[model samples]
Target: MNMSRRKFCGVGLLAVISPLGFPAFANPSARVRVGVLKFGTVNWELDTIKHHRFDAANGVDVEVVYFAGEDASNVAMLAGDLHVIVSDWLWVSRQRSEGEDLTLAPYSTAVGAIMVRQDAPIHDIPDLVGKKIGVAGGPLDKSWLLIQGLAQRDHKIDLAKEGEIVFGAPPLLSEKALSGELDAVLNFWHFCARLEANGFRRLIGAHEAAEALGASGPVSALGYVFREKWANENPDVAMGFIKASAAAKKLLADSDTEWQRLAPIVRADGRELEVLRDRYREGIPNRPLADEERDAAKLYAILADLGGERLVGKASQMAPGTFWAALKT
Candidate 1:
């Protein structure tokens, strides 16, 4: 049967107008993509992803992927590929101020410390002058903060101008320092212990570093994050991850046997599992972000005075209301 052009046009229009038609099939529900750091410990969040802690039978399906570092994880979040980032707090203020819809949800475990060689000419923070100081990553700001804090208290040295430090991520600095590739290095957790056993000296721990900076104890060190829009849409999944994570934290915190349980899953470059076990027991602690607005404000004030004013607006404004509220129970 030959159809007229007007009839053909009318049929095409009907296809577009049909509510219960195949056009509905074109759209698909988004799967939750979670990102983890490559060499990050067997913490609660990573364990949750590994052991399928979150339920898929509900509404949304969750998938886990590992990136080389937190920087890469942030890139994934910005690209909309990741629903959450279980990593550091440095990105929180930086991302939020940029107007990115990302928010911190809860705290993870305490990361570890910075180490130097025992016999190295450097004894105190002031000794790190023209001599090279190796950190895990080049220009590693986190490690550099230790030097900055020490300088501010002991010598009034300006980190921006007076400090000369270097950073190298994994295998690079660790391997080099072990094999005599560099002078002294800053390390974390298991790696710090390894450096000590291998004859490297302990210069400073993260907690001690914070203290020297004239601050109080164990500030909110590391934690998790999610896009604001994504978290709002999938509150169930968010809550599920948090619940599973809290459980893992309790397990790790309570017993020495659980530390052994985590050994096989945790890995570090040039560091043994036993060292990691000790680090896990001593260093990492599962704690929530505090209600101390003063400390939060202090961090912002320090960063701003240190030329990181571009990263945050005001110290008083840096509260963990939405994210911290999520961890109440």
Candidate 2:
């Protein structure tokens, strides 16, 4: 970090150029800067991590930087203001291709679902035909692309053309779907949980779609990311963060008391609490990425086919460092 920004960029490859080794995690007291969104279930897990002192227990001091929105957090990361951020692989792959050297470590596989008002007659992909469907992340949303890919693969239907699509914010999507302005909707797990709380029903979920799409294990798309150079230099901090998060995930899974403690923060109550917890249980991956895993690769392929370079950028292949192969090591 002693070099000026221009000098750092002039070095070409993102590999660390420091002759002196970066601080090792053995010291146990150094804090790793981590960024977290202020809302959503990730916030709940992070709060658990802090409240339980998971970072200190693992011999790494984690400095949690809170961002009100994911976009602000992403901007903070790109500006080199933080060590890690939770985001999807599509952004990581696109950034890596642009010489940013970002890499991913698995977190949760929790994803969105296709939901409809309780009274709606729609039941399956075919039923979506000629109906107005509300979408949270818009046309290029990875989950939407996955369903499109699944439909094309199994039923030979193109959802992009078969349904009337409405793109809007998650809150608006929920409001419209509930008020009957939209016949159905696709929203992230958290949004879907609240929808179910309000009597909306899922027509399909990501887990089911992943299984139908031939994903080998849990279909993981989002995770924690950091610069490859920084991780290689601070090996212990990198591994400690991963190990500590895994612990928090396990705790969230096994303890009802802990779930109760986190309920208010996660915005769960009554039946919505059950819905969110079930989504959490389903999302924890059985294992991190291994050589044979193709979930991320398949998503990339689907996005490419659906949206082309405009969405995924010009990377013709999966970025080499996109999935940190070292987590399982």
Candidate 3:
């Protein structure tokens, strides 16, 4: 058979045989069920993977299940309804500390930022003192902790003590900032991107705060998390999924055409779309896994100190198996 025909037949056969187990004569293609937020930014890459058949190219069938919220996805993950889920490594670390066997492969380094109206008087962290600050993700938000850590370390200013802090959802906080009810707002990356498009300026980014607090480089706050035991048993499938993910990221990084195609689903246009695309591209994790892990260890220490037992659980340091070492290549 010709190459194209053979490839088509292979895909067809794999789909048919996947549920019954691979026949001895054919190469196996594993099906990986991934759970993700319904409208999360991760969808951009996942859509790229599907559009380009990256999963099939890498010997896996990618089945994406959408969840409404992180809590729902986490519940599905723990219930074994998902083979993988996009989540923060810190939560994976906490799970591991609590005797779960989860491990994470770095996904994105895109973190939140403190935003202010373009003409707001806040010029630096110290200026945030005595201002009405709207913070998303509540008291133990990692970005908030990092910013707090930087303030305390550098200027000896306690943000939580000095500022009138109000915690709320990212959208609500963003609206409040826009309406001038807040002097500054720290919000999730996507919201920050929107705020940037709307003439808001970043007072400080989470990445900058992380760097100021001694992280070696841009550390990925989020990743594809799955049980280590499952990955070990299905090494080829795990590697294949990781490969597909990387391929999707590369497509996103290289092609504006892909972004154009994604515009509708991303539900953005003009400057908002442009800012979102650029920010997402910027957030892609390009550092070596070893470097990322090292930075994660350092940041974990800082967060543990600031967020205490509530954020990190019983672990004094990041658990050894927190980052999957097998995907290093």
Global lDDT scores for all candidate models: 0.55, 0.76, 0.86
Candidates 2 and 3, the one with greater lDDT? 3
* Pairs that collide, model 3: none
lDDT of 3 by residue, 150-210 (tens): 9999999999999999999888998888888988999999999999999899999999999
Instruction: Candidate 1: give its CA RMSD in angstroms.
Output: 13.8
Candidate 2 CA-lDDT value: 0.76
Candidates 1 and 2, the one with greater lDDT: 2
Candidate numbers, best TM-score first, in rank order = 3, 2, 1
Each candidate's TM vs. the true structure? Answer: 0.73, 0.87, 0.90
User: Over 4 Å off in model 3, which ranges?
Assistant: 1-29
Sorted on lDDT, best first, the list reads: 3, 2, 1
Best by lDDT: 3
| Model 2 spans with C-alpha error above 4 angstroms | 1-29, 291-293
lDDT, candidate 1, 300-319, per-residue tens = 55555554544444533553
